[model samples]
Target chain A: MKIGFIGTGKMGYPMAQNLLASGKELFIYNRTKEKADPLAAFGAKILGCPKEVAASSDVVITMLANDEALLEITAGSEGLIHGLHEEGIHLSMSTVSPKVIQEIQSMHAAKNQILVSAPVFGRPDAAARKELWIITAGPLEAVRKCHPIFQALGRGYSNFGEEPARANIVKILGNFLIMTVIEALSESFSLAQRAKILPQDFLSAINQALFRSPLYENYGQLIVKKAFSEPGFTLQLGFKDATMARDLVESYRVPMPYLDVVYWRFLSALNHGKAELDFAAISSEVFDSWEDHPPLK
Target chain B: MKIGFIGTGKMGYPMAQNLLASGKELFIYNRTKEKADPLAAFGAKILGCPKEVAASSDVVITMLANDEALLEITAGSEGLIHGLHEEGIHLSMSTVSPKVIQEIQSMHAAKNQILVSAPVFGRPDAAARKELWIITAGPLEAVRKCHPIFQALGRGYSNFGEEPARANIVKILGNFLIMTVIEALSESFSLAQRAKILPQDFLSAINQALFRSPLYENYGQLIVKKAFSEPGFTLQLGFKDATMARDLVESYRVPMPYLDVVYWRFLSALNHGKAELDFAAISSEVFDSWEDHPPLK
Candidate 1:
């Protein structure tokens, strides 16, 4: 099978590498040429633009950073829709909004192509291990047609049926849950620490109790250790997902007061010039009010 | 050990019933005499007032509803302190605030008695199964001394150390997390339903995904089925916990924005007359918003 992988950044590189190692004819395109250079060792064809890549592959997978990049890359001369074979599928696995996915679907349909959204849930480390949980929504036949590359890129797939954008919505909401956990833990711990309980002790009890969520355990570790330099997902993206979630809520008239509070926290972190840090770093703002308090014994 | 258990409501009844079935010298007290009647058949000494119950027992366990009931029963003329003996252990296992626990502890201490705070986590069903996860904090010796009773009342006990009031805070925070999950799930479902996705589908994804905290799964059933009548904890208490959690945050100089949002959601439900309904009934407000539009399909 001829496959084309685009935007080989953090998540995309490993995914594209996996596809290349599958012994399929892999054509790659990247906004930055350096990312595509490494795959040439595996006999992967490096296409300079989307049009060239689309002309040569049976499938074009978009693993861009966010909605903006995805839209930018698809709306102009170098876009994915103009590059794919007439019958090819664009398996989009980026974290994006449902409306954006619907737009891509509409555009792709106009071009007589298919856009299958398959946003993934896993950190960069998980992606490197091929341990990511991938969710797809599109035609069942198209999903089946692209199984080999999907299997190569991810551990497993959850098909939410033919409206592929629904998968993107689910993925963003899932990310929203993670960020919500971070914000709640940060605020609660600051509260507990003020009440003379150690933040670590509070986290330990919560992690050990029925509220044992991976999001809590992982982000709680970062908050406890105060590690915010690097992240599985950057603070910027975390804020973006929160905004997307809030947007969806606004459109639906479902009040996201929790996300609203969290949105401001994200904005604080963004305004504080820590957008490049881990999303868990938002906990720092939570602890700001207690900066002068004696540490809990 | 001669033990006194005050309050025999849904939680108290099962917890006290479990204690009595364990072959302890148990004295039971309830505002209503009917509740204490059934336990009397099982070797319990049913008492009329908190004084009689405390006077006849070496250790008094307050499991009453609300901080008010607990305060009154323990502070009334026939209250726990009114009859407490020197060196008697006043073990409070109710869900309440840390300040209240500290207040009661000081009052009991001045009376030459030792108070231990041992707030529990688990639903009525868990209480019935005797599988409650008890978060205990108090003097090490006191918690150790009360181990047999603790074991009898729940699956196990986790010693959170010598600060008895800390356990009350832990229990409160745990409830806070459960409430966050409820609110998050409620809002997410509202968004999903507006987006024309099935509530059942969205809930199943949450249950199966990393967001699958037992809190979500349990509340997901309530929200999924829209079964909000016949309160277990009651939305009023949910509101109180939210307010208490908010007070805890503000006291410590931390702003709990998300919790504040959820607090008022419960408050709005209260204002809308959902005081007696299940806290899950807050979903009704979210459901009501989508009554006319018929979410986009």
Candidate 2:
């Protein structure tokens, strides 16, 4: 069965290329058509929009940026929901609000089209390596049908029950966990630096002792070096996920005491002109300018 | 060189046992001597007090509970400092305040005795396994002299510098980071549980995805299971460390915005009668009572 891929942004571009390299029969579409052009040389058929891509393929995979992008591509006047064949599957591989996933699932259900939420964990680089962790939920049959596509795009996929939106909630919750870790590291680095202990030293101590994770090693170094210019994940998008998590918790009537702190740290990072930087830039929001303090150690 | 091991608490008991098992001549002391009796089988000699332990050994290791214990053991009438030999070294293996460490260092310096702050990271079980991470700071010569002792007691050690108190600061900061993580996990778990996502599910997703630290895995499981009865580190000691961090940041004029939040979480947990519970019990502070909500997916 032919597969159509949508949204060739940082994460999607590498992910889609990995599928192409795995020799999948592919069709592609993006709002900025040029982004999809690079994949065309690798035997991917480029399409004008989601509608054409859906009409041309058995399964259409979308890795759109956010809620509005996913909504527009799937439910807009000339969208995939209007053109997908009977029993055709739409595999959502983007991180979006669970509520939006539920709405989109209903839209697909009305026409007897299958929708599977298969959001992923990892940055763009991990996507390129096919090391991304894929999370899936929906009808078991549809998930099984899309197994080959998942294998090509990610290292593994975790199935979280039959509700497509459950995968979305897991993705949202996953990002919320990331932001919380970043905030914790930011606060810790600030405390370490202020105490005449190098931020890197404090990071090394804990990391060596117990926190032996790639998340700590990667973000801990970025935070210690104060290097936030490169945007693996922008602060703006990070803030969006935080807001979504806050909304999810509020709707459920659960209290997340530190989430507000995570949200505000991202908001404060944005306010300080860190929109284009990596979310690890939130460290700046938690710490002051280094020059203001005398040599501590 | 004869080694004196004081404060045979949960961590210290296992740690001292390991040292004695490694064939070191050990003189042990504790407020309640019964705690040290277990070490006698491994050729450890019981001493009357910190003063007697210091008098009988070339190097004294004090692994007390807090600043007050360290201060009382080193500066009180029957303290270690009074009995230490002219060139003897005091290897403090406790989590205490940097200010207190500095004061203790001064007391040792006045008596022509050397002091090295060599605080550790790990729970009681890790200490038993000799997997505890030891962090040190003081004169390089003293640190070098105590290298064999550090090797016997821990997996590895990181020396900060000649400033003895720097190690204490690192230990305090490490505990602060752990509390921050517990607070973050507590908040995130509440959001996930309320959102029909099980806390264990949220934990599995994050642990599998990014935050795959032992810190996240261990405490995440404990918080999810609501198993805070057994104290790896008590909520009271966690609060003391948080208070120490707050004081450190305040003294250094460094702003740790989320530290106050952590301090309050621990304070609130204490207020609700969780002083004896594990610090992961701070999760109880972030989550509402189980009766207030129905079972979530």
TM-score of each: 0.91, 0.96
The candidates' DockQ values read 0.38, 0.52
Query: Candidate 1, fnat value?
Result: 0.45
Highest lDDT scorer: 2
Q: How does residue B82 of candidate 2 score in lDDT? A: 80
The deviation in Å at residue A60 for candidate 2 is 1.0
Give candidate 2 misplaced runs (Cα > 4 Å). Answer: A289-297, B289-291, B294-297
Candidate 2 CAPRI category: medium
Least accurate 10 contiguous residues by lDDT in model 2 chain A: A288-297
DockQ for model 1 equals: 0.38
Off by over 4 Å in 1: A17-25, A36-47, A72-79, A148-150, A153-155, A293-297, B293-297
DockQ of 2: 0.52
Pairs in steric clash, model 2: none
CA lDDT of A62 in candidate 2? 95
True contacts kept of each: 0.45, 0.62
